[model samples]
Target: MTRRITVAGVSKFFYLYENHSNKLKSTLTNLARLRMRKRRKFWALQDLDFTVDQGEVLGIVGRNGSGKSTLLKILSRITVPSKGRIEMFGRVNTLLEVGTGFHPELTGRENVFLNGSILGMSRSEIKSKFDEIVTFAEVEAFLDTPIKHFSSGMFVRLAFSVAAHLEPDILIVDEVLAVGDQQFQMKCLQKMEEAMSQGRTVLFVSHDMRAIRRLCKRVLFLDQGRIVHDGPQEEVIAMYLQSFEDLAHIPFPDSESRQGSGALRFENLALIGSDGVPRDEVAAGSDTILRMRYRCLSHLQNVIFSLTISSLTGQILFRCISTVELDSPFSVSKDGVVDCRFPRLNLNVGGYLVEIEASANGVLADRVREAMRLQVVKGAYYEGALPNRQSQVLVDYSWQINPDGA
Candidate 1:
């Protein structure tokens, strides 16, 4: 297959300013200064080189400020790179934000045609696919309505529909799929799969590792505006997760303020591994534990504590509960600390969350929303098999084979 997209020696840099004057304006002024300060060059992407073959789907994963969005913008021609060159052989459709080229005063119908034209679609071509776009977006009722009046959900639907159905040779998507509900997200994923089957090239950027693993054959990990790792889906994701120590250790002011609410107050939470040492890292498919030490402030019974793991993209992989599956509820008197183990963690390689929630007397007593973040380091665990326990809810499967001399 011929290479459809080539990013050669790409480097993007911006100036981050330092100070601002006014109080309310100070924030805005500071942000502006942050964007334009001299002597402070922030590299959003540097020395990045990659090639996407025709019909290939590539996933870019990184934290905020890692240049994933910048790279997408450069590729989509929304922004020019400070350095480097990108070669594209075909038309590219991008859904970087909810309303990229929309005119607020224009009706949905007009904007669809306008956005489609901007994406290189002819008027006749857009008209031929007009109903399909509206139907997929489910915005028939608001088609004639001005886009400014549409809700965020409606805008997302219409925008995604225009980007997807136009059949551009290369599709570049950022986190726009995250704006809608679960059903719409699933629909978008399905549409991407359909596009893949049709042999279109896809460049996908997402913080959701699951979507990346499910959709892309290759992955790239960026850190501080540089492509740190690029390879197979699993390997790249694993490397990315292992690199989260920089995040977990960044001290938050008054850490106690972030504690979960419950009869028991969380004293400390740390990710520990077989080494039995407190670590900000853990290997995938390894024996790891989220050791959360909590002290009961008062006598409590029939209390349940749970931890939920989610990708940064807001995908929940699995949740662990102490009381339900363990089938044991105990009373805590006065003050004491207990650690719960999440054995053989089977999460795909990515940054995950360890949320703490507790219920007492059949009601929610205390809970912390996304209390802690964890990263799953890649190891030689899966070999070729899928991670364990993923069979139940995360993915569906089927198999086919042709027997010879039947």
Candidate 2:
């Protein structure tokens, strides 16, 4: 089989300057100082070798700054590699960013034709597909309005619709689909599936493991600008997720990113089983507790602590809020621990993330994303059987039926 895309020893290097002044200074200093410079060279991708068959759908997964976007940009030809080579055998279309390849001043209607031309489509071809694109995007009402006026969701919908309908042989998609609502995201996923069914090659990058598992047969896991694992989707995703198993409890200040007023910040986070023992693994149908230790820098009133349970892919599955769930106005005047106990955690066997948020008087005090990780194992849920991954949560219910002649 012919390889549709071949990336061999591809590496991209970028220089980091402190500021505009530093960038200018570095340029001048390099000229006079010969080898002395303050700028730092960062490798976005390094020695990445991969090939895609004529009709393969490949998924790329990594944490932030993992070179996923850098690899995609190189593949899409948006940027040149500092070293190595790439060979592509078909017309390529890319959706690497929000409103990519779009003219903000042009109306949505005009951009469709413009994008089609860029994709090597004739005017007649674009005209024939114009209606379908607009209908699929559901942006007919704003067809003539400049894209600058469109919201992020609208931009994503229209941009994805055009790229998917342009009939390119190779499509490269980034994580931009997260900008749209769930319905539109699903629509885009379905369209990608349809394109794959038609024998088109796709390179998809997403944090959504479920979507990746559903679409791609192979996966590439990148870390620190290198391909750490590249193989079957299930194996790669499992390896990628298992790497985070050690982060059972994370200190708030040591978190990579955080937001809020900082009046109150979480000190630590942990997951405990029914026996109140800190454990990363919990039974599917057993009770579990999420404990958050926090300190109040100042007196705060009407503070609510909320915890959100999300899948490994970052989809929020369930949320518990102190104000809403407990029906009590929470306040913090000193250091304490807030425990969110679930009577029965029905999540199937999988890895999940916990996010914590603290707010005071309707103002955000502190928030942490993916503060903790937990793994659910086989338990008494669904007659002691593990539910399929497709089912987000397992629910207990009873069914009743009436006889025909009751």
Candidate 3:
């Protein structure tokens, strides 16, 4: 099959701030007397190579300022590449930024045709699909209202509706989906899936890993304007999420005096592997250790402390409290620090937060909301029947396929 979109060694450079002129004071000083500002080059894209077959949905995942938007802009022809080559075989419709091609002065109804024409759609073609676009966006009430009066949400809704329904062979989407509500985002996802099933090509850039994993068979991981990984969805997303987790940890302050609830305060929380040295990063499916130190005020009895391990979504994966076992209740004296250690962490490849909570006599007590977040980075995983807390839960069981089919 011939490739529908081919990007070979694509490189895009941009000036940090182009076309600088002192307007108010300089206009009277004479046009020729104005000082020309020197321009500095910034490379938004570098030697990027990828080919999309006739019917492929490619997902791009990266953090903010990763140049994902710049790549999409280059593909949409809104910006030209500084040094690279690209070939497109069919009509391309892009939903790049918020209200990229919409005319604020024109009514929503009028802008649809204007955008369609800009995408090379015929007037009759747009006319036949006009109502459908308005209905899909659910902006019929504001169709006659000028786009300048519409809210940001309304503008993006109408813009996406126009771009998606134009029937372009290749569709490019950036983070613009974030403008819609959850239900609308799902609707757009379904539409993209339908388009993919019909053999249309799509290039999606989003920070949402779940959407990327669900829609695309392959993904590209971008870092600082360069492609670091391009492969299966699982692998690429894993790499990107790992990189994110590594960077999530902010350096602890040097001051030993940390503020917290006066009743109880946590002094330090650190990640220590089997080696006992402090570590900021840990591999997934490994024996890791979490150590926390805290000071208690006023001697308390029947004190139960709980540790919660959670993902970025606030889903609790592992929980351990002193009350799980009735054998005894943990107690701490007044004005002294205590330590708690959790060994053998079994988490998949992702970032997790360790939160500590303490209560007395079954009453509400103090807790650290997001005390520390850890990144579980690795490829290997243990799969078995376990409580489906999150996507991957390990029961730590081993099975073998015997000839008797056990």
Best prediction by lDDT: 2
Give the per-residue lDDT digits (tens) of candidate 1, residues 1-406: 9889999999988776565233676567658777533347778788999999999999998876688888988998878998889899987888776556889899999999999887778999999999999999999999888988887568777887888786888888885554455577689889889998989998888766667878998998888888888899989877876665454444333344344345666545667664454445555544567765566777888877788877676777677788767768767666554566755556655676677766766666556656677766443234212344443222333566768835
lDDT of 2 by residue, 234-292 (tens): 89988877654445334555545799888998887877665455544666776778888
In candidate 1, stretches whose alpha carbon ends up further than 4 angstroms from where it belongs are 20-38, 148-151, 245-406
Per-candidate Cα lDDT values, in order, are: 0.73, 0.80, 0.71
Q: Which candidate is the best by TM-score?
A: 2
| Models sorted by lDDT, best on top | 2, 1, 3
> For candidate 2, what is the TM-score?
0.63
- Tell me model 2's lDDT, rounded to 2 decimals: 0.80
Best-to-worst order by TM-score is 2, 1, 3
Clashing pairs in 3: none
Candidate with the larger lDDT of 1 and 3: 1
Per-residue lDDT of 282-399 in model 3, one digit per residue for the tens?
5444346666565676776787777788778888878877677557886767644344554434676567887877676665456676778777543223311123335644445656
Model 3, C-alpha of 207: deviation from truth (Å): 0.9
